[model samples]
Structure formats: C-alpha cells, structure tokens
Target: MFQGFNLNVSNESRFDSPSTYDEILKSREDNVRESLENFYNEEGLLNGDSLRKEWFPEIENCHVFISHSSKDRELALKLANWLYHEFKIESFIDSTVWGFADKLLKQIDNKYAYREETKDYSYEIRNYTTSHVHMMLSNALNSMIERSECLLFLNTENAIRNISLKEDREQYTFSPWIMAELQTSALIEKKQSPNSQRPFGSLESNKTDIESIVKRAKSFQMIHKANVEHLNNITCENLSEWAKDCNGEKGYNALTTLYRDYAPGCR
Candidate 1:
C-alpha cells in the first residue's frame, strides 16, 4: 500500500534503525524544503524575485492544510505523507503538536494551578472566555489555515452530520475544530481575493455528508458548487483506469485537484 502510494519505502528501514520521532519529523521537514527548492530552481524562479512574484501573485506560501477529525488522525497522517512523498507538496496536520499539547494539558492542570498560585486579582483582567491553552490552540490552527494555499477537509460521517432540529437548522455546525478551520480558511480566502469562486474543497468516501456540507457552505457563501467533487463518483475498476480518471493526466489526485481549483496559477 505504501509503495502504491509512492511513499518512501525506506521508512521501514528507518523504523528499524531506532530513530526518534523528532528526528523523523526533522528529516521530513528537510525533505520538504529540498523538494520545494528543487521545484523553484527547475521553474527558473529560484533567484528571480520579480519572476517569482509574477508566477505566484496571490499565493505567498503554497501548502495544503489537511482538516480531519481527531478520530481519523492515522488516516490523515497517511494522506499527508503520501502528498509530501508522491507530489512534493507540503501538507500540514495540526495533530502532531496539538494532540500532544491537548493530552499534556489534560494530564496536568498547570494552567488552573498557576491561576490559583498567583491569586493576583489583576490576572482576572484578561478577557478571553476560554482557557489559555484553548486560546493558543485556536490561534495556532487559524494561523495554519491562513497560511495554507488550500484547505482539504476530510469528510467522514463522524466528522459531519445533518441536524434536523429547527434550532440547529439556522446554523450548520460540524466538528468544532473542522468548522473553525473551514470558517478561518473562508475568511482568509475572502480577504485575499473577494471574487474567488471557490476557496476550499472536500473529499469523502461517502457522499451524504459531503453533499450536506457543501450545500451548507454554499448557502453561507463559503464555497462554490463547482469546486467540490465526490471521490467515490470517480472510482474505476482497474488501477490504470483509476490513475487516468481519478488521478488526472497531470497527476491531480483528489487533494491536488482541490488546490488546483482554488489556486489555478499555483504549481
């Protein structure tokens, strides 16, 4: 499966080599930087500021932000790894640090302990409703979405559901984090280009949630009708057919297709 996805097969060797997780992450980061540099050099824009400016007028940093439910962290990581190795496209998933931090915060009540230890009335002057940890997480996630060239939402039935209640009908809500990322991406996209037709895309093995989410997004003017594609609709009987149809001639897989739709001029 890894070979079919074009991931680094040597990862098995590395796993056997006793490398630390931090070391693996560092190596991946270095590989991404090298790949991007090579891409820029091949395009003759490595040293030409003006040429680079013209080539990427709107996109400053080209990277994909993968938004998925915490329950699907492993699947999200697999997709991100495939994206980096196969397409040389940098992808970001917040679970690496966010999940760890969240777990640590839950394990230790340091924030509340600090508040009690200080007892400084002036500290209460802070206006945020949520805890400091949550505020930091929200900021970090919003920053990632803002910096990303495209937001690829991994749609699962668990992540999104249709609420039939009248109160919920007025405002469509998915997983809180997913909703935040989508809204943040939409805000950034609108700020950058108010007239952009589609600011994001979604992928799902099932169509029910995708259709509902897309409809809700369009009703709120977050995404365009033509921007989203149902991946299951494009499946094929054979591998070659799958590659040709699902993965386009230029190798626009489900994720890359979203990036292309949002940023046409981006490489």
Candidate 2:
C-alpha cells in the first residue's frame, strides 16, 4: 500500500451519477467479457492457469484502485471515468473481476456440483468451491492493493455504521470484504505507488442470537471494526482541491506535495 484515503461519499455527492461514463463502462465490460472467453477451450473447459492469471494479473503502470461497496459500483465507475478525464489516470475496479468470479463459479457448479437426485447443486461441493474461489479472490485483491500507489476507499453509510458498544462508540462495517481490505491496507508493506507518478490499488461470523441477528441483518450484520484510523480522511471539499491541483503540468508537483504532507519522508 502506498497511501490510503477514506473518501466520504453519498447519494448527494457528484460521483453519484454514472450516466456520463456509461459508454466507457460498456466498452470495459465488453473487453473483459471477450478476454474471459479466451480462457475457455474448445471443449468448453476453463484453463486453470488462465483463470488464475485473470485473478492475479501483472501490475500495470499508473493506475488507481477504487475500493467501494458493490452497491456503489456505479459510483466507482463514475469516479474512475472522472479520474481518467481529469488526470489521465487509470483505475482498477475489482467489481469487474468480481463479476468474472461469479460467472466462473456458476460454470464450475453447473459442471461438477449439480446433482440429479437433489435437482440442484450439492451444498458440500458448493461450499468447497466457494472456499477456494473466495480465498484466491482475497489473495488477488491484496496483491493489487499492495501494488497500487494509492487506495481510495469509498466510505458511506451504506458500508459503515456507528454502534454503541458499552461505554464507548465504535465504527463497524457489515461487509467482510470491506473489513479485509481495511485490514490489508493497515498491514501491507507501504511503498510509493508507481502511479502516484502512475495510479491505483474482513471478518467474522458466528453468534448465538435470533432477534439480534435479524435486527442487525437489515443494517450491520457480521460487523468488523472499521480500521480507517490509519488512512487520511478525505471529504468532497478535499477532492475538489486535489482535482484542481492535478490539472496539466501541476499534476506531478501537486501529487508530490500531497505525499509530502501526508507521508513525510516517502519518495
């Protein structure tokens, strides 16, 4: 991880509308779909190495990794487009990879886990496959975060909650994915992102309650403490200035200043 930002965004935020980048997103999805098609052989079986390579691709130059709730995917796409338009920055949006993962799982289940007796996929097989797929996906995501120069996590009420825990207040996120990313950002080796010249870069369960689970399910189920204290908290106001400062020839200088202020002694 080079640097991380917990960017507060909401429905009222400028990034809410993705219409501006609809065409670009369509093109991107099409490209990804086509690339995935190559992973299937004439027998219709997926190549293991190809599939693994899809999950863990080589690090690219000058990219930004946008970490946001899947619910905020449109917003993330919009932000990605905005970054490209304003600063010629590319972004690694994992949701694209996630869609591929879902497709891959369906293919795997349909081929091997389906049971004629049950008229559905085997629960045991599904669990087994899911475990392997999720584990690989988690590893791939961490690899990207470590490789990217900066990580901007979209922080919204949709993803986090403030809970009253005994005498103290604590922040938590229901998404295990968010928890994992935050933890990774906190622990990963920090190095200057090539894209700072360039661009881009969970937990637990178990419990023994019914009413408690139901109430929390609608809002804060399977919570993990939000580990954003290590990140720079950025608001829309800060984003606006960052955008202005990143224009034209000032872009590199502006980023250098930002790194200097936020990450002293960092190259």
Candidate 3:
C-alpha cells in the first residue's frame, strides 16, 4: 500500500494492495480524494466545447457543487481546483468554513432590487445552491451519472458509502467517508442500467416497477407514428391525399395493440 501525505492506509483498510478497481475505490474512501481527482484529469472526460454547445446550464460554464464532510475540506478544495483547471469547471465547495450556498445567496440578495422580497428569494437561492452541493456529493459517489446526464434518481440510497472511523468514544462509528462522487455516480449507473443476464436470471424475471416502461412505450408510439406519416407525406405530395389512403386508423390500432400487449398501464 502506497502511504504518504497526511493519511495512512492500514491493513484494516482492505486486502493486500490497490491492484483491482474496487480496491482502488476502497482506498480512496479514506479521506484521501487524490485518486478521485486524478480520474477526471483524463484528456476528454469533460469536453468543454460539447458541454457548452449541447448541455444546458453547461458544465463547461456552470459551477459544480462540492459537498464535503467538514473534516475533509482540504481534500475538497484540492479536488475543486483540479476540476477548474482541467475542464473549466467551476466548483462550489461546501465546507466547515463556509457552505457556498449561504454565501452565494447573500451575494444575490445584495443585488436584488426587492429588499423585502429577498427573504423568499434568499430561501429559494439557498435551497438551489444546497441542492447542487448535495448533487456534487451524489455525483462523486456515482460516477455513472454525470450531474449533466439525464440520470434522475427518485428513490435510492445515499451516494456515499459508510466508513468506520475511531471516535471520541474509542469505538467505531460509520460515517460518510467517501470522496469520489464520480465513482459513486458510476455505481448508480450500474444499478440503473438494465443488465440483460446475471447468474440467477435476466432482469425481466424480477421486475416490478412499470410506469416508466409504459410511458416510454407511449412516447415511442407517438414518435414512430409521426415519422411514418412524415415520410409518406414527403414521398407523395398529392393535393387529394386523405386519411383512408394513409392507413392512419390502422397505424393507430397497431401501435395501440402493440403497447397494450406489453405495456399494461399505458392509456
């Protein structure tokens, strides 16, 4: 185990050396976020041009939220600067010193025309900033979901993993010791993604939730019908074009039947 800097990875930390990917992750969880910072240092992990041109509230331009356990502020700041240098990523760090949200809201309220209305806007701004900070934490934990990606997690476990830290009581206590929000994001992606096959069976056998599937089917039907009609309309520019020749009803029925057969809840 390569031990240096402020912290040391003892035998109790994990097996042997940081040879495998999981071992590397487990080692970095020990308040040493250097590994996490290094991952994003990749050449094109965060493409500034594409981020600005394609993604809204662009990562290349927008500030990232950095949520750190107060004890790990130094590591958080180091990580934040790392992001800024490589991808032009602006990181908002929340630390024991000062959570960025409160500071940002104060700045915003100071500039707001409505002094009395600042109270409500203050609350809203504060919440929004706080949310980003939390998002930063979540993103660090699950590298699979970029804060940019349409990865919407409604119900899930906290992104950070618990680490046993010796406390004042001389006993072990589990704390959120994770520093790599990106790795955590990756893990979440693993969970959210559909793995076709596993040792036990396919994902289909154990499925429960179906609303998202139904909604997807409905959306696909709409897109498919529109594409079909558009192609036909472009191919034949007749003034006498009518629905009877277009098979609009049949297309609708086929789409409806196909959806009903598989998507139970689609209306």
Best prediction by lDDT: 2
lDDT of 2 by residue, 166-212 (tens): 97888888888888988999998877555454432101122234336
C-alpha lDDT values of all predictions: 0.42, 0.69, 0.29
Model 3: per-residue Cα lDDT over 113-211, one tens digit each: 213432223446545644644454333333322332211111101222323335422211122322333224333322211211221101233234334
Task: Report the lDDT tens digits of candidate 1 across residue range 96-152.
Answer: 545433443332333322244333212343333235445556676776666665455
In model 3, what is the error at residue 230, expressed in angstroms?
Answer: 46
The alpha-carbon lDDT assigned to residue 177 of candidate 2 equals 83
RMSD of each: 16.3, 7.1, 25.9
TM-scores of all predicted structures? 0.46, 0.77, 0.22
Q: In model 1, where do residues sit more than 4 Å from their true spots? A: 1-62, 103-108, 111-130, 167-174, 190-267
Candidate 2 has a TM-score of 0.77
Alpha-carbon lDDT of model 1: 0.42
Query: Candidates ranked by lDDT, best first?
Result: 2, 1, 3
